[model samples]
Target chain A: MFFKIIVFIIIGIAGGFIGGMGMGGGTLLIPLLILFTQTDQHLAQAVNLIAFIPMSAVALIIHIRNKLVEFRHVLITALPAVTASVLASLLSKRVEGADLSLYFGIFLMCLGVYQLVSAIIALIKKKKSQEGKQSAENKRELSENRQD
Target chain B: MKKLLKKVVVVVCSAAVGFVNGFFGGGGGMLLVPLLEKVMKCPVKKSHATAIAIILPISIASAITYIINGYFDWTSVLSVSGGCIAGGAAGALLLKKLPTGIVAVAFALIMIGVGVKLTFF
Candidate 1:
């Protein structure tokens, strides 16, 4: 039992770290619990949701102190988000655990592909911008040499 | 009219974010961060911060639903939450020192690999 608790804590640390980086720790947490432990899909999901509350509350406090949170925008998005979340959570309870895990697997794959693509795109954009700056600097150096 | 359309878009998108987060039990912030950054023109850090704010309430609502439906397990919740708190602080501190693009790519690859294993095996 102690060993099992240690494993769960390690998993939580991995997920929390990702989440702390703002990359959705729950996405990784649910899968890790389901795979590494004997946790049921629903239970794993529940753990992710509950664990996030305190973790995020701490981060939110820090962000608030730093003046990073945009309160006006939060309200606009939050109302609809809350309503939809409640309905979806209720719906999830009705789904079978195996089926839910299968669906979640598919969802995770899709999100991974999307993240991969976007990250590559961003990398390419960064490279192009850097190259543009280098060429512009080279051109300036050549013009300066001609004047000298 | 354009402003009204933008508001409509934000509402529709936020609802989608909530639905995904609720059904999956977490991840609303992933969808929300981009929406805030691109659609709402928020700075990256601000979007990340605001995402936590938006997701916090939605997560609480979903968690309540899950608990009401009898999904709560005390041991797992306590253990994981404890670890999460510790690791989250470390991650936040490390964020500034890391090269985000490379980390993002590595994380994406890991997600894909794990996702494939879960789906097929």
Candidate 2:
């Protein structure tokens, strides 16, 4: 029992770290719980949902203090978000756990591919800009030689 | 008309975000940030901060539903949440020090690897 708690904590820490970095910790957490802790999909999802509450609440307070939260925009989304989430959560209960986990796996892969492609694009852009700068410098040097 | 269209788009997208978050039990914030930045033209920092504000209430609503459905597990929740709070602080601090680009790449690879494992094995 004690050992299990330790394992759960470790998984939570990993998930929290990723989440704290704004990389979607619950995505990682749900998988870890399912794989390592033998948690079923629905339960794992439940754990991730509940775990996020306090952490987000704390972060929200800080963001509020910093005036980072836009209340007007939040209001616009929050109503729809809450309504949809409640409907979806209830719907999740009807889905089989294995099917849900399988779907989640596909979703994770898509998200990963999206992130990877975007990161590679950003890197390529950076390299291209640097190369452009170097070429411009070379052109200037060549013109200077012609002038001389 | 354009303004009305944009509002409608935001509403539909927000609904999608809520549905994803609720169905998956997380990941809504990831989608929300982009919507805010690209569609709504919110600054990156503000989008991230506001994402939490938006996700918080949605998560609370989902959590309540999950609890009512008998998905609650006290022991795991207590231990995991405790670790999450502690690790979240550490992660926030690490974010300032770490090169985010590299971290993002690594995280993406990990996600792919895990996803494959879950799907096939």
Candidate 3:
């Protein structure tokens, strides 16, 4: 029992760390729980949802303290977000467990691939711009030396 | 007209994030930040910070439904939450030091593997 508790806490810490970093820890948590701990897919999703309450609260407090949050916008987003979340929850409840996991998996894959490709492209673009600037500097230096 | 259109965009975009988060749990911030930044003209930092704030209520709404629906594993919840709070503190503290780009890449890979396993296997 003690060992199990320790394991669960460790998983939470990892998830929290990722989430706190704004990496969407809850998304990763579900699969980690299911793959490593053999937790049921639906159950992992529920636990992550519960844990997010506190985690997000802490993050929000920090953001608020830093004056990063804009309340007027928050109000606009929050109401619609809450309503849609309720509707989504209702839909999720109707989906069977296997299908739920499958859907979740598909969502992740598409998002993941998209993000990864974007990141790689961004990196390439940055490198290309740097090289271009460096070569431009080299050309300028060559012209100055030739004149001298 | 343009102002009202932007406000409407905010609601529509956030609603999409909310629905996905409500269905899955724990990932609306990604969708929220860009929408707020582009549609609402919020700065990136403000968008991220606001996304965190927006997440809390939506999470509560989703979690309540999950609880009522009887999907909880109390033991995991209690144990994990203990770690989550502590880890959140640590992550926040280390926010300046970490390279989020690397983390994002790693996260993407993990998601790919997990998604494949869940779907086909």
Candidate 4:
């Protein structure tokens, strides 16, 4: 019980960090729920969504106050995704225990890789763009000197 | 007019996310979270929560779709959610005590492993 509580808090913060970063926190939360709590996958997902409710609310309030939320943009994903979540939730239920775990594990493992790869790719692209801008600026300065 | 375009973008993007989410129960969030974090540059912790918040509406919408399609499993949702809350609380607390570096490293390793698995297996 104590271990479980400790695990939950840790997962929350990690999930919160990921959540704050906007990766949906489920990737982190679901795995922790499975590994630490020994919950089944579908149940883990349900728990993941349930835990998300309050956490998300608090996060949303902060974003709203900071003017970080783009309401129009948010709706774009939320409406359809929510609809999909229900369907997925239903479908997930029919999967047997081991199969559910295998699928969830695969999903998590894949998602984690995607996050890291995407982050790295984004960083590289950003660096290249910065370099391009700097080179352009230098060329502009050189041309201006020649004109002078 | 500009707002409309933005709304269109949202709808399109959300729809894409929704489609993927509907197809695979996990994706709406996985995609949304990073897009929000990287593109929006939302602060990590806050963005994490916000992603979930954003997912809430999307999840509900998807849930409805699932229900309409006759896929929703209330018993499963209830059981999982019940377990998750308790687990989530514990996970949240455990995070505070660990060194950030350790957490980061562990997370990174997991991400790398998962990424490889996804790409190959």
Candidate 5:
């Protein structure tokens, strides 16, 4: 039991850290729990949701201190989101365990793909903008020499 | 009028985000970020930060439901949360040193693998 606690703590920390970073550690938490711990898929997801509350609260506090969050936005988003999430949670309960696992797996795969594609695209856009700046600078220097 | 319209848009987007997050057990940011960035015209940092805040209440809402439904494993929740708090703080410190792009890719790959395994095997 103690060993299990230790392992879970480690898992939580990792998940928390990733989640804190806004990378969605629960994304990792659900699968890892299901895979490594042989936990039921629904149980794993439940843990992820429950644990996310504190993790988000902590991160939200930090972001608040840093003035990263706007309360109006929070209110607009949280109010409805919470209501919908409750409904979703109830619906999730009705899903079969195997189907839940399958859906979660599919969700993770799609999320992963989205992350990779977006990162690569962001990198490309960054490079293009940098190149554009460089070329524009070269044009300005050339025009200045012509005026001289 | 414009302000009210934007607020309405935010509300609608947030509702969608809430549904997704609640349904999936978390992932609101995926949609929330884009909604704020593209639709609400929010700054990137603010969008991400607010998304986290938005998730807090939503998470609690779903979590309560899960709890009432007896879906939680207390030992697992306790152990993981203990680590998560500390890990979150630690991750921030290490963010720069870590290759975030690579990490994202790796995370994605793992997701696909595990997702496939769970779905079929």
Candidate 6:
């Protein structure tokens, strides 16, 4: 129990930091809890959800203050995403530990790839918009020179 | 007046965050936490804790929605939540001691992961 407490704390710190940054902390927490606490996977998943209650609240408050949040988008996506998560939770009980970890790892890797890609896309789009604006300005200047 | 407006935004945002949080299952909390930290100017630790607090009502509401439609596993939620309460406190304290930068990078990595999962996986 004492050892578990120590491990839990370590996991928590790591998870909290990861969680704070908006990474699915469960990627770290679920495996760590299972390994250290020797707890059941379902329990770990449930614990992950429950723990998120507090963990997320703390983080959300900060994000709210910073105005980085998009409430409308959140609403649009919430139902589908929550439904997926709940459905996944139901199915998780039948899964094996290693299999679950593999799936989760794949999920994480895929998620990482997506973020990198989207950020690139967003950046590219921004650059294009800027270029478009500059070209428009150039055209305007040319017209003014022709008028003169 | 601005404070009042901000409060309204917070509630609406929080509700949306919660609802979306409930939908994603486990991770919208991560999104909300950092948004709180970065956008809302909340301290890192407080943002995390607040994310959880905001999530509860949303989860409950969503869970009820699930339950009405017969989607929940009461047994699973009970078991996992039981262990998580204790684990969370430890995680919270542990979070307090770590360097902020390490935490931030890890989060960014995770976001990248989430983005991948959402788009490709």
lDDT of 1 by residue, A15-120 (tens): 9998888888898999999989989999999999999999999999999999999999999999999999999999999999988888888888988888889989
Residues A37-140, model 2: lDDT tens digits: 99999999999999999898988899999999988789888899999999999999999999999888988998889878877887788889999999999999
C-alpha positional error of residue A31 in candidate 6 after TM-score superposition, expressed in Å: 2.3
Candidates 2 and 3, the one with greater lDDT? 2
In CAPRI terms, model 2 is classed as high
Please, what is the TM-score per model?
0.94, 0.92, 0.88, 0.60, 0.87, 0.48
Scored by CA lDDT, what does every candidate get?
A: 0.93, 0.92, 0.84, 0.58, 0.80, 0.54
lDDT of 5 by residue, A62-139 (tens): 889999887776766788788888998899889987788888777877887888788778777878999999999999
lDDT of 6 by residue, A13-50 (tens): 65554554444566566556655666554455455555
Question: Candidate 5 at A79: error in angstroms?
Answer: 2.2
Give interface RMSD for all predictions: 0.9, 0.9, 1.4, 5.5, 1.6, 7.5
Give residue A115's lDDT in candidate 2 (0 to 100): 78
List TM-score (chain A only) for every prediction. Answer: 0.91, 0.83, 0.80, 0.73, 0.80, 0.63
Q: Across residues B3-113, which tens digit of lDDT does each residue of candidate 6 receive?
A: 677656655555555543343334456556656765567666555545555455555544444445444354434434444445544554565576544444545475455
Index of the highest-TM-score prediction: 1
lDDT (tens digit, per residue) of candidate 3 on B1-121: 9889877888888899999998887568777877887788888788888888888899888889988888888789999888988887788778889766676778788878888988899
Cα distance off (Å), candidate 6, residue B114: 16
Cα-based lDDT at residue A111, candidate 1? 88
Q: Please report how far candidate 3 places residue A3 from its true position, in Å.
A: 3.1
lDDT of 2 by residue, B38-102 (tens): 99999999999999999999999999999999998999999999999988888888999987778
The CAPRI class of candidate 5 is medium
For model 2 chain B, where is the 10-residue window of minimal lDDT? B98-107
Q: Enumerate residue pairs that collide in model 1.
A: none
Error of 6 at B91 (Å): 12
| Candidate maximizing DockQ | 1
